[model samples]
Target: MNDTTWTTPDLTGHRVLVPGGTGAVGEGVVRAFLEAGAEVIVPTRSEERSAEFRTMLGHAADEHLHLVVHDYTSFAGAQDLVEQIVHFRGGLDSVVAPIGGWWQGSTLAEITEQDWHSAFTVLGTTHMAVLRAALPYLTDAGAYTVIVGDSSAWPVPGSGLVSMEQAALLMMQRVAAAETGSSRRVFSLVLGPVTTRHAEGFVEAKDVGTVTVAISAGPVPSASIGLHDHGEVQTALSLLTAGEAR
Candidate 1:
């Protein structure tokens, strides 16, 4: 990948909630929003994880990053979290759900019930919980972006469960966008192997963040976007930026 630096738009006064802000790809999303001057709120299940995320972002993020220790995996917990955030932040402007996990080791036919539940049910429910809780409260112009892997569109051997869940999320985003009409925006950001802090791949995590920030900001070209590699990322950014300018 080329050493290209892209600019993040100014997002002053915007309030954004990132449910999976502690993960590898989520880290990029959180930092992008924080750097863009948004009031970024991250929900973590434990205090230790919250502290680690804060440290990962460093001292500069303290003023804008609000790390809340809360379990948003359950429907009730997600509702409560949304209420708390809206009450405190005045209103929510955006949500970026980069929440999910990689599953392997068993073929679809060979997988146990527990494997299926762990790999699909838990993660899918969490995404749904957050969507149900926050969708109603989102501002009219607000955006809801779901980040999933390219597996959503393709099958992976021994990881069929992950693909199933990811595909479900993609459909969820589509349904949300259609149901909401033009009143609100919903986007599915499909990514390939993301190059994060711990791994190497085609697209950088920061680029993922940049694209997400662009989507959150406005003028997205479509309800579904794919960022499989550096070229796709740049194309997405250009499209978003162009739309914003027009």
Candidate 2:
């Protein structure tokens, strides 16, 4: 996994959208795409947050970067938000939903209805809402999507809401592939822990287990920064960027 280089495809002014672009993995996606030369549009809940994210981006590449006031929690706000993003980019090419959920403290016996809903909102509702909002531009661009998900979502015991939601996302991914029929594409990168921020991102043991498999299956890039497996996350970004070209 060390000899081969997982080159991040050059975006060169390409318009790529990343939802939840201020969260843990979202920030990593933003930085990685920007480094690869895409005109990345990060949509979030507030303009203030947008500015803060811009500041987080560090250097200004005025010609190749932007932030949008896109809130996805509301069905009513979806259309207008996409309209605004489409207006900002002129055309859209890619989207990365590095958004998800995680909670380990509670066992099934201790889980509450609220816990279930909290996980659902992150893993299910958020994905549905954002995808619904962007489907227009996404279809227009030959729809490309990446679902960041937990490994435990696959038949793991006591997973509760997260598994159900991840399964739904997986079904959507497969159904989208069939429905797209070469017009568009989507994939679920059952994500693993990525070290960028202290908290990094939420990925289960199963996710990490898959990373070992991918590495064993082929060359793995050195993307982990500390205990955080940035390599896994960066590899996912590399795949999404490459999908645009294909």
RMSD per prediction, one decimal? 2.1, 7.1
Pairs that clash in candidate 2:
1-220, 195-228, 195-229, 223-230, 223-231, 224-230, 224-231
Residue 37's C-alpha lDDT in candidate 2? 73
lDDT of 1 by residue, 18-43 (tens): 99988999999988888899999999
User: Compared with the true structure, what per-residue lDDT tens digits does model 2 show for residues 1-246?
Assistant: 231445444557566777766776667656666666777777677878877777766784355677777666666565666677678667666666767655554666778878877876645767776676675566333334554455435555666566677778777766766665555545455555554454545443323322322221222222211113545434543443343211
**Judged by TM-score, which candidate is best?**
1
- Counting clashing residue pairs in each candidate, in order, gives 0, 7
What TM-score against the true fold does each predicted structure earn?
Answer: 0.94, 0.71
**Residue-level lDDT for 107 in candidate 1:** 90
10 residues in a row with least lDDT, candidate 2: 218-227
Q: What is the Cα-based lDDT of residue 136 in candidate 2? A: 52
